[model samples]
Target: MAPNRWLRPEVYPLFAATGVAVGICGLSLFRHITINPEVRVNKENRAAGILENFAEGEKYKEHFLRKFVRNKSPEIMPSVNGFFTDPSRN
Candidate 1:
């Protein structure tokens, strides 16, 4: 007998058809889950909107970092330094 003879030829087509059906169902389900309805509707302008949001976030992050550094005083420095120096504090 052939190595693959354990599965009869008659059942092979059934397995192939089942696999194709399952594959199509899986793809449809995955698309339904991952795709946002709003994004799908405005697909034409999605890239531009995403880029604008990303740029806005970067500007906010820069402003926050600058403000944080400018507001840091000498009084708060010692506590920050001591936290790292003393191992027993852990």
Candidate 2:
């Protein structure tokens, strides 16, 4: 009995290539659909000017701690006092 047309060796590579191409396109589409445009833009803007807006080392440290670290842990709140202290004397 003869093998089916799709089962032929020549057709197998074509099918494999098409399957790989479709998988790549599907993954690209999924990533675009899942990302939030506003968040992406905000991240880009922050990367561009994050340091320029907070030139002082202390201000930048305080802003980061307040935004990300303070709410993350109860134990950190007490030790965070050191972050606000005047660094010139230290």
Candidate 3:
């Protein structure tokens, strides 16, 4: 009797990677279904529905990364931006 070929130490990483990929895809799908207003709202009250949907959307809140950078300078490196923008520094 031969052991299962799929059950091997070398193939474990592949299984892990596959699981992670599937999990990410599942989460993305779930997020799209739940959070996407366009998909949630229908034609009956599209005008009001969209507005309401957007209002609900706002309640869910923005991503942490966006909130972190909101109202922040667009510059990636402030020193470099200052060096180029400051006439006195030239």
The per-model lDDT (C-alpha) reads: 0.67, 0.60, 0.77
Query: Which scores greater on lDDT, model 1 or model 2?
Result: 1
- Which residue ranges in model 3 land beyond 4 Å of their true spot? 1-3, 41-61, 69-90
Q: Could you give me the TM-score of model 2 versus the true structure?
A: 0.37
Please report how far candidate 3 places residue 30 from its true position, in Å: 0.4
Candidate 3 residue lDDT tens string, 40-60: 545575555435456666755
- Predicted candidate 2 versus true structure: per-residue lDDT over 1-90, tens digit per residue: 356855888898898999999999998677555552322345565476433333444443465447876656466465566567759547
Pairs that clash in candidate 1? none
Off by over 4 Å in 2: 1-3, 36-90
Query: How high is each candidate's TM-score?
Result: 0.35, 0.37, 0.51
lDDT over C-alpha atoms for residue 48 of model 2: 62
Report the Cα lDDT for residue 22, model 1: 100
* Steric collisions counted per model: 0, 0, 0
| lDDT head-to-head 2 vs 3, winner | 3
- What is the number of residue pairs that collide in model 3? 0
Candidate 2 residue 45 Cα shift, in angstroms, is 20
